[model samples]
Target: MSIEIKMPALSPTMEEGTLAKWLVKEGDTVKAGDLMAEIETDKATMEFEAVDEGVIAKIVVAEGTDGVKVGTVIAVLAGEGEDAGSVSAPKAESPKAEAPKAEAAPAPVAAPAPAPAAAPKADGDRIKASPLARRIAAEKGVDLSGVRGSGPNGRIVKADVADAKPGAAPAPKAAEAPAATAASAPAAAPALVWYDESIPHEVEKLSNIRKTIARRLTEAKQTIPHIYLTVDIQLDALLKLRGQLNKSLEARGVKLSVNDMLIKALAVALTQVPKCNVTFAGDQLVKYSRADISVAVSTPTGLITPIIRDAANIGLASISTQMKALADRAKEGKLQPHEYQGGTASISNMGMFGIKQFDAVINPPQAMILAVGAGEKRPYIVDDALGVATVMSATGSFDHRAVDGADGAELMKVFKALVESPMGLLA
Candidate 1:
């Protein structure tokens, strides 16, 4: 019997996907759990695996096809010596939560251009151009044998085209110029010259993930009035504590990062300022009993925030392990929907990237997000005496509808104390 293979729903929010590429070909044998196709969602490109072993029969959907609704049949799988006419599946309906299904068989592509025959020697026979240059000359309709090379032994380079006599049909006007003195540099970053008329561009339809992100962020910004609060934490103690912890944990092959400590501190501090932990729920406040913190990670396709559930209950050691796992999965685009969605709060740390300070957009349903910056040694007043201390700046973006100025400040107070003291996180 033949089996119809449809596009799998990689995430809860995925409604449609672009067929990026197919991995298998028609008439090829496939095994269960074999990689078949790569689908490009709004956020990432994920691989689809075959569920049933069979011989490839047909491919209905071609690659580069967009707006392909989920459950759309892209291919068919059949057993050896079996006719494929009996297979039937609802292609219009949503995909079932079945085991992995479908793999893309590699399809045929356009043939490559043939290599050019070798030109007679140019050493004394006048400079002969390469096949690529000859092809380019043909495309641009330029005579190659007539051009002389400025290169060693008279080998023609693109520069020879520009150096051609100006009156000679405008020597490759489209050719780019080589670098010159700094003064001749094209305005560092070139400034756009204004046009008298505007040119129209084709608009692309938004993908499912992009549409969801836009709608959620727009709603959060419009419905939820945001309040910003900034604070600087003296991290001398925190730095010392992290160094000590790393020394002890180094033997165990576990390394703790400063962000891990902050995650733990934020989780513990959320309990002290419960208001910040609550989400806006219609007319009432929906408070979470445990702190589920989402850490923002940048991926090739888009940004993905993976959650560390009940972070407050976990120690720094556990948080480090979970973060590494989450980062690896995120890069591979293999994370499940639940692994990234539904967090009460989020933390975005650009400290590693040397970002001094920046504000973050609050992810909806979550009332607040904390942006952390790099720690730097700076002059500070310590007990009425001027001293240099390592300090890092952080800013909290809170939903004004759920948290007020005083509430936001109080929440920062807890964050400041926890981060500055550092050792209190263990307590």
Candidate 2:
């Protein structure tokens, strides 16, 4: 017997990916948990592991193949006692076979649909669901035990889990609606335009990372209602405190950046104003108990946010040390999916680039993101008199649907206070 190995979904949102490289050849023998290939998803390149021990029989999809759909057969493996050389590759349907049918029947025949309410048991013990469905269920806190399957062999699919209501009765199989048909009318195509080729230029294709970024940011702007709030805070105190702390901690090899202190401040602010530390689900609001701050780091590929778990609880030195290591790894594209996946809120600092005051887009699921700008010398009022101070602008972008304006303002106030006071973050 031979086993067909299909392309695996590396992330929840991944529909297709590039098969970057294959580590094993046709004659190579592999054991369970052996590295087989490198798959490049929209976010990062990850290694794929073998789940069953066998000898590689054939490679259906070659390396460097882009946009290979998930669950498509990528390779074949010969089972125990099976001859690898004798295993035949799966045959693809030929267009000639369908030509006769097209002439006989003008209308095309639709493929047979799977049952709408088949509850396939996995290994005759556990419920079987797609990886995406499982992830969605976990995030939405929906009890999969109570959900019915509507996929082939009673396997649960994404649509089944998405339509499952949390804490509600399982929808009756008879009540399941038929899948909607495609529109009879075709969408109008946009006008084609071309640039003059006489002007010397080169065209570069968009990378997977760039494409994903464009799609996500466009969706974020169009779907998520954004509310921007800005506040100016005196950074003289924070700068002074950072200098003192760095001098004192020099022997310990821990030097903190202003961003490190800002991370702590934002985390503490979230705890103070807990309303801002939440995610907006379709029908539910998920409030987190701890502040896991996702700090945006720019790499050659694009921008990635690596999270610092329990930022409010960690010391400044630890935050600095951990952030440095995470940023380094992120630049090299070595971060694991879990490291950049989830956070209660996010922070994006552009102060290093001397960006004075700019708004940032809110990362979806998170209720808010704080954008930190450069600290510059400016005239300020001290005790109702004229004074020169180092000031910076901090802008907070909130999801209007999840966080109220007042709550967002309160969180910003607390953040500004902590940054100005400086001792609260250390304590």
Candidate 3:
């Protein structure tokens, strides 16, 4: 009584998925609710759980299988003691004795079944793990196919490492720690080695996420006609407001930042300039009733934009809290696709990094993006006097198809006024 296990539709737009890994193997028992596999879709990687208790009868789709059509029978589940390996595994045609080891590890490195090559080869080095396992291993930076499995049918369960003691496995004989470091540490500069001058390094292909970013950016640039708007904002008043607020809250736990103030100001301006808080949805213009602003945070992987829903209605304290939480989540790679998507507007501030000026690519759907730079003091004609004023440069990139020059400039003007006036944000 074997039951077919097909890939579930994880998202509305998902038509295919890369089987990331199989949690269970032939003859391995599984219980309902147990996480059985990981699937990488176009947007995000998600876990698949068991729906029924049974032994894995067979895995039809091996890990690293790309373009696996939805609803395909990837595996089979059978009642206890049922022969699970009765179904023949799909065999792929080989070119070399084994396929060339350097063949790109597919667009997705994660799949639910074992890869065609039992040895997971990365950079021509043999790796042993399901595509799903390889993805997890790659993410965790663990050398897979290198570690022995302790699960039924010799499958590597995620918990095996959790229960293992350190220094238990045999050290690798194929590679050794740098001889110079293992023997005696080298001085400040080591004698020039022949390898240092002409060593050739192989560059691996970009991961799916990186490829998607490159593709999206290229599309945005080529498809959208971009117009840049630059404006200088006086920040002395805003800094003064922050200092006063912090002074009043010395006993309180909140310390304020200029970026937080900028967020608040931007939110206010978006609310005033409703046109800027809209996306260029083809066939019809889509204007949002609320300002859901995505703030770009730089992570080790790349730039991730986390949304602050209804940012116009939130206070500066709340904005700070949300930004901190999103930044932490972005660094951990725990944010979901929705958490990093669907914003009517976006903001990228490099002021803290001391960047004087920069232009940002408009995150699609959203018609405009604002880039903020470091604040500096400069001579200005204020009222009737020539005096020193702290000014910051902000640039806006707008989709010409969606936002006109007046529409874009109006948003910047509002932002400049609110930031310079400072009290307008509190109002």
Specify the highest-lDDT model's number. Answer: 2
Whichever of 1 and 2 has more TM-score, that candidate is: 2
Model 3, runs deviating above 4 Å: 1-5, 20-38, 49-65, 75-199, 243-256, 379-387
**Candidate 3 to native Cα RMSD, angstroms:** 12.0
Give all candidates' CA lDDT scores.
0.73, 0.81, 0.71
Task: Please write out the lDDT profile of model 3 over residues 1-427, one tens digit for every residue.
Answer: 6777888887676788777677777778888998888786665566788888888877766665555678877778886666766644323322232455435544344552324432343234443333434444433445444567553234454444333333322243443222212222222123334355467764343444566678888988988888999999988899999999878766766677888788788888888998877777788888878888889887765677888888778877777777888888877656766787688888999988999999999889789889999998889878889998988999999998888899899999999999988887776
Worst-scoring 10-residue span by lDDT in model 1: 99-108
Per-model TM-score on C-alpha atoms:
0.70, 0.72, 0.66
lDDT tens digits, residue span 124-196, model 2: 1345555556655654446677778764335465667776776632443443222111110111111122666
Cα lDDT for residue 401, candidate 2:
92
Please tell me which predicted candidate would have the highest TM-score against the true structure.
2
Task: Order candidates by lDDT, high to low.
Answer: 2, 1, 3
lDDT of 1 by residue, 284-371 (tens): 9998899999998887555789899999888899999999899889988888767887888999999989898888889988999999
RMSD of 1: 15.9
- Ranked by TM-score from best down, the candidates are 2, 1, 3
